[model samples]
Target: MGVVADRVVSILLANGVMGMRLWFGQVRWVYRQRRVWVLPAVIVLGAVALSWLVPYLDRRWAEELTRLPTGEFAGTFDASVMATVLSAVASGTIAFSGFVFSVVLLVIQFGTGTLSARMAPRLTQDWVVGAALGTFMATFVYTLLVSLRLGARVEDYQPVLSSLLAIGLALASVALFFTLLTRVINFLRLVKVLESVSRAGARRAAEVHPYPLGSQGDTDVDLGPPDRVVRHAGRAGVLLGFDEEVIAELAARAGCVVVAVPAIGDFVLPGAPLFEIHGGTSLAERRLRRHVVFGIERVVDADPAFALRVMVDIAIKALSPAVNDPTTAVQALDHIGALLLNLSGRELGITHIRDRAGAVRLIHRCSDWTDYLSLGVDEIRYYGRDSIQVIRRLRALYLDLLRSCPSERLAPVRDRIAAVDDDSAAFSTAFDRAVATSPDWQGLGGPAPIDDRQC
Candidate 1:
């Protein structure tokens, strides 16, 4: 009976855990990706329910407001006053919704054309904007519902509280509408967007890969031989995160270290080895995959490189011959430099995840300083060969990074500087080389005097 009970508990746990995986998948699809309408749908439904409840609630609670003397409370919840307010809220909100959507569409176009196209797709994940949009739609719906309860007869009831609530929502919607415009404008500005994305990435990177105080003892990172491999299942997507606690249970039972074969944000192809169980002879592909989440885009939760990916994409696109927008590339380098400065002093390539018994359960691979430097600047430095502003920004970046980086990491940055020198040397004339020789703070527009000391 004990054995049977144990088996039953295991089955229930398995089913419950798998259900969590399914729920997470849906969440990632509806809210995690670019689908921004889910919150609005929920808000509208709630508003409809509240529309019915508000009138009943007012009649039950606020009959005194309805019965106030007309001389003292001329503008109170009279039938005409209620009708006018409801009609105004409904029409004003509908118009406001249209205007807000138009602004969003315009901003999307501006961001896609001016900023990184890759970054533009994730704008919907900004739930502040989502909630704003949802409020406008919900308020419109609420007013319409409340307007239906009105009667033509003077003796009929007028919903004072409901009309007052509608007025408040309308006011809130107006504020949010303007707030949305401000947010959209900030997002539209290329520098602001780059800074925001870079800062978010840096903050997340620091959280996930913080510097260890003294030493982290007894971390057995060197599990000898991989005895088994677990391949990917179902459809392919970017590996977003892992349920470390759940995986720890599986690893404890199996008595092996589960190494995530693909880095987070990496595109996992079908049949690719997702995990390598070191020091164990068996692997459970189905059970393990449930804890490994995948999504259409990279999330910053654990993936630092996703931010780097976005920065590089923008720089590369700006450096394209068709765009020839070197200033934009330089602007990207400014934020990238700050991120690198933040990363230079922190611990990186932090791959170990420990279980309940303080045993290593999972390994997550990630990029370090060299990798970030390459991803952030190498392609742009190579692509923007003819652009003097790009080269100078690259110089400034290296100089700043070199000061912050440790002694061992200095050589690679210097090597990049040498490469910059070699690229500028390709220009035959001394004058043209001088143009590329200095860091141009002003870029192509108004040139700053050459600081030959640094050169």
Candidate 2:
């Protein structure tokens, strides 16, 4: 009974408004592209449409509208009062919202100087900020129409209730206006932004790969030569995410394993191999691309690497000569290490997709521990070689990772440590080299004896 009830609830939820929002391609595009005006425009349009209905609704509920206590709730809202409030809401909302929006954009622009401009999409697409704008617009439109209902004659359809509602809504808009500024301040802090991105990646990683790390994997799935290649058109953007369930269904219908070529954050080029369809007899590239979504820039859609990418951005910026902040680089390493640790225990790839009858229909291989570690480590080490703070922190990070990860994952870390040692030899003074070369977690100037021992 419980299982059946659960299934019923799941079906209901899937058909709900939120479910429709999640599944719609165009809605997802608005979110990914950060079309800041789209949602608010819809709100404004809806408010205008609703305004037209207010008179009819008020007439239908004339008894309820007239009997409602207007004492203190409407505060002597005459035609002048109504006009004053509506005008303030309409004009003040536009002016204040414009100022806040400009400030936020400026903050994002300044942030791009330190972080990557690629991150700008994130702030622009924020739902809270967008909704704030929408709320102001909605309030303005509603109040304007309600104000029009106020008349000089006592019985000329005053719309007392609608006017009061409008005034209350205007007050609410003022509150939302202040909240938008708060959001702007919080969004300005780069560390906060990076942390949010990392957490988003973690949440997505958890959802997509439910199995624990080093867990059982598909035993025998043929991920051999592809029967056909699905190339992308000339549109370039960050691959945000795809509807995995929908893709699985399409693949099931076609009887093939469609493996995505580039990871989520990769800049997909024109004529690039987007998918390799194994055992696909007559799959159209257009049909397959429909399941994928590419935005203006990378977002934490499903890829775990995006978090690491942001961390690397911070670390690289810190290592740069313009902003010599090794401490910030070290800070990034901590979060990167945590994200890796999260992945270390979870399964990495989708090796097989099965139907209801447990028939294997798809095979894919996502990048494993080695690729992610290299992304987090390689360039920073190359760029920050001269900084003792960076090299030492990396040495400690690797030493800790070496002890924690499975034996096979140790090779890349070990190799990188050796490379760091060589870099230290070529670049470092004797004292700093001694400090960096030490095998311990913090580069304590001791022998790195773990290389000989079991990983």
Candidate 3:
């Protein structure tokens, strides 16, 4: 009976730990999505705590400072004068914070309308905007508290330390305000935005596909039709990601192969099939569901394709009739090509998780090369078909990929090149068709090889 009780306690403890982990993961996912307010809230709280501590320290230090020779240099101000200064600082900072909020709103408006609406979330989540707002608010709170403390005292007890610290924070707020303006201006630029998205996409691609293509040997594990299916039991949400190690461990213990039905970034409704368990003892549905994370919207942290999707959105938006900005479309393709180049050398497709005994325990789908290639190129080709500059840039991008990508990847590149030719054929004039079909690395007015002008 003691042994059974001990085993039961251990299982309970394991479940407790897993529960905590799942709860923490959900909180983190929500925080990342809605983190704009978190930093400012934390900073304001810190200021409130500091308001009490700084006055306490100031009282202690004031007593000691009077005994020092340099006490006169500490810039003592009367209580009334210090109160006025603190009030002024408080009023100015609150006004500054309002201005900062206005600027951020304008940035969001301009960025979404002029650039792509996808960038709205990114703009809102920017740390610069959050930090600037937090600093301004912290300064206001600290000064207001200090002033209130001074007013409540009958004796003229000047908080020299608190006054100096408030001034320092005010100065820091000014500096950050300027920095925020600079960042807002940079965000409005098209090239800067493209570079930012491309860099993020490259980082995610590196994380998702760390190894060179074909570096790991592919093993054929035929796990036929599933013996049982595990369906989602929670509210409907987008599948953000899953803990592979945990799922693999669960599958290994059950002596089964688990295949994920929905890929990361897929929206799974309640009662949808989440996993298919093949040839194993029955596992708890709660255990399987806990390991998979869900969120309101897909994020780039797990979805490598999201970056490409954003850049493509920017490109096609530029190519729209109202925008009619083929140059901007070409620039978007520049970054898209860079992201593709980064992915070209990496491993992609179905991922297999193995147990200690080398048995395939978990199988999950990943975006492969062709998916990425089509995503990065097809929309721009279709939208900008008549624009000579866009077509030339597309031709250049395809030819560049043909030369750089591995032999196994060449077929897709050729197919895209053929598609570009078909697009070019729609040009109204022969001269326009010829120029559009030819590759120009600069998109236009760049040297083309004399012998390579077959089109």
lDDT (0 to 1) per candidate: 0.73, 0.68, 0.81
Model 1, span 200-275: residue lDDT tens: 7776665555543223434556667678888887688887766655776788787888888998678998999998
Tens-digit lDDT track of model 2 for 1-455:
98896575445333332332353354366444477778889878877877768655755776665565767433354556565666667677677767877887798888777776656766677777777778877887786665565433235554556665666667777787788777677677766776777786676556545455544334476577888988888588766655555665677787777777876567888889888888868667787787777776655554667767877887898788889888778777777777776776666655444443345654445657777788888988888888777777777787678778877677878898888888778753687766666544332343456453322
Name the Cα RMSD for model 3: 7.5
Q: Given candidate 1, what's the lDDT at residue 182?
A: 82
Q: How do all the candidates rank in terms of lDDT, highest first?
A: 3, 1, 2
Candidate 3 residue spans exceeding 4 A from truth: 1-33, 71-75, 154-156, 279-284, 450-455
On lDDT, the stronger of 1 and 3 is: 3
| Candidate 1 accuracy as TM-score | 0.83
Backbone clashes in model 3, listed as residue pairs: none
Quote the lDDT for 203 in model 1. 61
Q: Relative to the unseen true structure, what is the Cα RMSD of model 1?
A: 8.0
**Model 2: CA > 4 A from native:** 1-33, 59-63, 69-75, 148-155, 214-238, 261-263, 269-273, 276-287, 357-359, 426-428, 438-455
Model 3: per-residue lDDT, tens digit, 271-310? 9999999987867778988777787776655566888998
- Clash pairs, model 1 backbone: none
